[model samples]
Target chain A: MAILSLAFKSLLNRKLTFFITLFSIAISVTLLLGVQTLKTETKTSFMKSISGTDLIIGSRGASSQLLLSSVFHIGSSTNTIKYETYQDIEKLPAVEWAVPISMGDSHKGYTVIATNLSFFDHFSYANKQNLTVQSGSIDDDMFAVAIGADVAQKLDYHVGDRIIVTHGGGEIEGHDHDNIPFFVSAILSPSFTAIDQTLIISLEAMEAMHTETHDHLGALPGETLLDSDHHEHHDEHDEDHEQHAAHDKHDEHHDEHDEDHEQHTAHDKHDEHHDEHDEDHAQHAAHDKHDEHDEDHEQHAAHDKHDEHHDEHDESHEQHAAHEHEDTQDQRIARLLKLKPENINAIFVGLTSRHAVLGMQSYVNNFQGEPLTAIIPAVALQELWQFFSLAESALNIVTTFVVLVGLLGMLSIILMSLNERRREMAVLRSVGARPSHIFGLIIGEAGFVCLTGILLGVILLYAVLLILQTPLANYYGFYLDINMLTSNDLFILLTIQCSALLIALIPGALIYKYSLSDGMNIKF
Target chain B: MINLTDLSFAWNKQPIIDIKELTIKKGEHLFIEGPSGSGKSTLLSLLAGVITPQSGDISILEQPLNLLTASQKDTFRANHIGFIFQQFNLLPYLNVLDNITLPCSFSGIRKHKALSQSKNLESEAIRLLNALGLDDPELLQRSVNELSVGQQQRVAAARAMLGSPEIIIADEPTSALDSDNRESFIKVLFDECQKADITLIFVSHDTSLKTHFKHSLKLQEINQATIKEAV
Candidate 1:
């Protein structure tokens, strides 16, 4: 207590120089801690942002790009997987749930994702916890859209409001969905990941738009938009009855009517063979018609030589329609998985367990099929570290420089004051005070100055963080609570204090040396 | 009593003070005179044991000052001797009273003796302050810096003369004061030394004050041409 009182009194004597040293130390510590705190929070946030996602499957583009487009709002994918492939992947024995993501569309500058309603049920950020709706619910209807919290707030979107989607993945001009405006059905609470930066729509809606686009573009010369394979096949079966009335376009129409009536008659007999078996019946009918056409061509060729030539020509025409119908049905089912004309670019999988990361990895690595991959949202996002590495290094360099400047400033100030204090020191020595007493006095003064400065700096750090918390959350989805000191913060502050003390010793040592030889009359 | 036998000293290989077989009885008042270059300060330092003689035995009260360790010498000086330097005789940061009490704070023997005579010592300090012709009420409580050089020297004399230490070493105590002040300071100091029956070694260039003291010595008479040459 006596020492403290004396120290306080002595410090009060040199308050200006003492406080200056302290304030500089405090500012440096605050800057260092601030930079470090932001760096750590960003890394933790990035890692936690995608922990719940198991695997991210995208089009057969680069795996890293697919992960980025699907998980992080980093880059875009080159293409998308076929719808059929997505369905087939879902049916695999090891697969639990597969959420398909259709990319390559955008609203304003935000990426527009075409996914099922299950996206809300599955997608997890920060943890494996399910995304909760803060205000509105998930949109289930095909044309309804869901926007993340930031997207909604920034764009002033509300439920029941209609908005048009812009095409080509960004703020591009051409092909706006002006004809069919979408309703804003749901807005997610902020997660601060790619969700906050994207728009969500249904896969059916995406498929419809693609199909409409294809129809808008004129078809090729040899192509036809024929309806059913069964009708086309039957038309091929009756070619011999057709060409006899060579100039009759009405005959072709009449043949179609007869085929329709026959199809209706087949439906009437649907009791004998249920509608579920209709596709099987069609397959059998196609084979039988092909055989009959072959027999007819052979018989005509055998019977009358001129009639055989015309009959053969008619038979060929009937076979062409039957083959066309069969090919059309196959093409439609095959198009579901093929990525060329229309395909799924990404998949958002939500697993039943938090260990869904394993499931995601298993699917990507063990799936026995064409080249494919699964990515857990968290892992994939972490793997996208180009920005994080750059940010960390840049912040580290700046913090280090600030700390050096702070220490140097303190040393310079303390050393300067020591020069003015020589007379006071000599007086103490003359009054029967030992050299050690002078040394202790100087060191104690420095330590007190540093500790005071660090205390002020800590208070300032909390105040600044508290002030910026709201804005940071609103802009970046980061919720930094400044109410209590986190372990990371405590560690940083401790290190700074220790470092300041270490720096303070330099001046103390200088004074100690000065008082040593100069006890005779300490001028230096 | 003080004793010096064959004392020799030097600075950077140049001789300073060389004295052989010098002794002062317990009640002697010895005055040392010297020009600016004469080694009066060096011999005083030697006698105070602030510096070691190259070849000598300086014993105060039968303890050889040079034979004792440096720390022991400090203790001996604190307990048995009082010093008045040419300047800075008192710490400027302390008030006049505190400066007067500082020697007692460091030396236990002095402290015990001064405390035993505490009331008398206070009155004596006041008397000495009065005798020095500094009667202002503000002067006694004021910081050392507020006092004139002569007043501060008087305060230093009172401090050194307090508690009746066996030896009092004054090194040009009046150098900073004017002729009139210096004369008054010497008279009072010489009278106090005689009254206390304390041995006094006063080093100064002012030979005019020699008439007041019982003993007078010149630095050059005892100083060597080699080891005790002038600084």
Candidate 2:
């Protein structure tokens, strides 16, 4: 303790120089720890970007390539999965749900995803946090599309604004879907995932745009939009009578085993039911018209006290009944158009039970008619990281080098200051401090400076994280949580402190040697 | 009491110190005069138990210092010796009291001796400071840097005399002071050493200070290496 005080006093005697030295160590330590934290957070956000879904089914090749292209929207897929194959796998009993993703388009720099409305229901990220529409609604209209939070922020888009997706790559292509421009029906809230960088549209909407010529795309946008909007209103009418009419879209797709011939069979089954319902409804309509005067006379008495005129109310009621009969015909045709997905690039699958995941994975991998790959998301992500571990290792090497340079600065500072401290050492030596005490003095002082530096570095990193969290999340979709320290951080801090102690010993030992050898001030 | 016999030291085989015999008893004040580069500081380093003699032996208080390891010699010096430098000897960051009591922390003998004379280390330091004519209580808590050169010199002297070590070596300690402060410094030093019965070895090139000591010697008379160099 006494020798430590002496060392402390010696340092305080030269406060300005030592303070600068300490500040240098603090700055470099911040950079080193900051890099380490960024690496961990980046890896975690990447992994948590898409969760809950069990498999990503695409044509066979490198799993990393598939993961990058499918989940991260980076590069391109190895091959597209057949839409026919997708429908078959979805039919399997082990499957709970599936989202077929077909792509090769972008809005500005953001990727454009073609998926069914079920994607808004089934797609998950950041661990089961579902994609939520912040503004507007997810409609079934083919031309209506939803934009992600980051995409909307960057493109300065709002609900009802029309945008077109580029046809080929994100950029470097003049061809764009200029004819069938999409209106933003919804804008999603940020999920800190790949979804934030995507513009999502219904699979049929993408198909509809592709089917049109560039000139025709914009020409008939008004007519198609009106038709799709009318279809949406009619579908809501089924919700009012939902108990009888509500059919699960999944069951409709699941029970049918017929392939390309499925359209006729399914349409006939529905057509027969509609015919029977129309006959019953027509008979009721004729009977209601005959009794219309009598019914209005009784209803008029009931509503006469509530409103001024009875004829006005009767006229509105008759018009609504007439419209309802015509709307059902439009709905039947629109419902048939809902199942028009011809192809998809990849499918995200969730098994009926967690245990069924592995069995179904291999069955699909060695699938009978064609080669395919079914990847367990967690395991595939792990493999992808392993393949790219070289980059991570390279990053590690750079941070370590930076920390070493910082420590060396600490070492050199103490060593340079030794010249002026020689007389002080001799004075202490004269008053009973041994060469070892002098040694401990220098080492202890160095350790103190390093420990302070480490603390300052950690605090500085968190402060920067706190300040940048919102902007990064809003613009880049990187939601950095400042709380919690990973084991890697703990290990790095421990290593830095240990190295501080070890490095201090070098200068300590050198001074001890000189103190032992020479006379006053110990010329070496 | 300290004794040396046939002591010799060399720097790169060039001799710096060559003393056949030298003896100083307890409570004796001796002034040793030497010119610049006469190995005066080298002799002090040897006597302070920092470096061993190349070819001879030194004994202090009946203990054979030549046989002790460097660390043991360090312990010996910490317990028994005090040193006052020409200037800038006090550790600047420490308060005067801490500077005075520092040696006791390194040596249990000095600590117990210091503790026995007063209530604690601080009071013991105050007692020594008072005897050295620095009686101001506020002076003890202030940093040594706040003191003037002469005051700093007195604090260094007070530190060396704390716990009343058996030997006090002053290496031109008054060289940085004005003549008036130099006289007062010598007076206070002699008075404290007399009261505590401390053996004093004061080395300086100034021969005028020799009259104050009971016994004195010139480097050319006692040191064979210096005589050879002079010839």
Candidate 3:
């Protein structure tokens, strides 16, 4: 104990060198623990991003790519699964619930997901925790949109604010769907997942926007207007005018049907046009009014016949024309309900039992309608995490080297001072201090420096985490839990301390030999 | 009492100290005078048991030092002998009181003796410092660096005389002081040794100071190694 106090006093005497060594050690400790904490937390948050889902089904592709694009919003899927296949998968006995997601749209750099209300009911994250609205409940109105917490906070959106979505992902310009703007009806609570950066709407609204963009006639059945450049040809050619007049008459006749039956039949008629539009838009646009009318007649004949009220139909036609320039929320909602999605990018599936997961995966892999891939979310997440292990190991190696540099600096400094302290050792020897006392003094100083440095490093780490927690979570969706030290962390710290003592042994042994020879010599 | 029988020592296989015989009774002040490289420091080292002679026995207080191991020798020195140097006598890191009480920290026998003199080590150190003519209470807490050369020598004297060890070995402790301060320093040192009955081994090449000691000898008179070198 006396020797330890002497060592401490000696260190205090060399204040400048002592503090420099201490600061170096403290900074290195901070880096070491910082890298370790980030590695563990990043991996934990990555795994937490998608949970409670048995499998993710997407068009045949790399399972890792599908996981990245669908759950992490990292990239876009190259292919989409047919809506019919999704329907069949949803009805399987092994599947408890399935949420189909359509992507490839963005609002202000945030991805826009098109899903039904079932997404809120079935999609979960971080230990079966369902997403709850922070402000407003989810609405069933076709044009009503629910935005994630990060989207609402970053874009400063509130319930009832109108937002126009772009046709493609990311921040590409000039593809905004200005004709169909959706309003925010709900804002989801923060979940610290990719869901926090998304804007969600019903699939009907998604189909309606694309359909309106292609047809330019607001998805109305049997009323396909020629491209704007062809409008003058209608006046010049009596044949084209007569075709348009007949099509206008057909539209007026259909307006007399009940609202439900009209929307239902209109959706059936729109499906054929949507498929044709997707197959070849230029060819669909080049078709004359005669071909459009013939196709519409076939779709109507396929449905049940209803009585036509000509006067009421004509009045409704005029109202629809008048409402084209300024469509209200109710008018937009009514139009959207009449449309249906043709395909979706991915589907999240939940199973009734964990044991049934493999059978359902095989079922999705051999899906008869289209080529698809179903992957267990947990397995794919682990595979994705492996890709990051190399970078994690690299960071760990760099920080470990930094700690070694700090310890080496301490060793060099103490070794250099040993020559200057020889007279001090001689004085101690004359005063009856054993050579072993000198050895213990050196080790004790090193131990004290390391212990204090570690303490300061931990404090620095917590301070940095506290300051950056909100920004990191908001900007990067990384949630770091600042809790007490884990046993693993304690073990790492103990290892560092032991290494310091081991390094100190080098100088301690040297000084002991010097003191033995310099005994009572009193050079000065 | 201290006795050396046919002691011989060498450094790097070159003879530095060779004495046929040497003996000093208890409470005696003996001044051994020698020039540089005459093995004045080597003789002190041998007396302190820091090094062993090749062919001889050194017995202090009837205990043979050669039989003890290196560690045992260290403890024996701590319990029996005190040392003061020519300069840099006190550890710069410690204050005057801690410097004086340092040996007591290393040796339990010295600590017991010091405690028997006063209530605790601090009071005992103060008593020794007062006897050495450095009675200023503030000086006890002052850093050793702040002391003048003469005052530092006095503090060194206080530390060596603190535990009432049987032997106090000082090597040219007055060499750094002026003549008047040297005399005053030796006066206080001898007064303390006489009060405690500690045998003083004062080694220096300063012949003028030899008048203070009744038993003084030059290195050539007793050291045959120096005689052989002169021949």
Q: Which candidate is the best by TM-score?
A: 3
Residue A405's lDDT within candidate 2 is 88
The residue ranges of model 1 lying beyond 4 angstroms of the native Cα positions read A1-11, A59-64, A92-96, A169-171, A208-342, A350-363, A366-369, A376-394, A483-516, A522-524, B1-9, B15-174, B177-216, B225-231
Candidate 2 per-residue lDDT over residues A8-112, each given as its tens digit: 777878788778777777777777777777777888887897888999898888777788888988887437877778878889999999989988788888888
Ranking by lDDT, best first? 3, 2, 1
Q: Considering only chain A, what is the TM-score of each predicted structure?
A: 0.72, 0.76, 0.80
| Rank by TM-score (best first) | 3, 2, 1
Error of 1 at A155 (Å): 3.2
- Worst lDDT window (10 residues) for model 3 chain A? A279-288
Counting clashing residue pairs in each candidate, in order, gives: 19, 2, 0
lDDT by residue for model 3 over A1-524, one digit each (tens)?
89989999999999888999988998998888888888888888888988889999999999999999899888875579977777889999999999999988889888888988889998888888999999876866556789999999998998877788898874667888776778788999999999999999888778767664444444344234433423453555544455445434334434542332333443343333334432112112212222345644542432222113222343454332222223443234324223446689999999999999999999889988889999999999999999998998899899999999999999999999898888888888887888888899899999998888888888888888898888898787678888787787888889989999999999999989887665578764
Question: For model 3, how big is the CA root-mean-square deviation?
Answer: 8.8
Summing lDDT over every window of 10 consecutive residues in candidate 3 chain B, give the lowest-scoring window: B222-231
Model 3, position B191: C-alpha lDDT score: 91
In terms of docking quality, how is candidate 1 classified? incorrect
Best by lDDT: 3
Candidate 2 regions with alpha-carbon error over 4 angstroms: A77-79, A156-166, A169-183, A213-339, A368-371, A520-524, B227-231
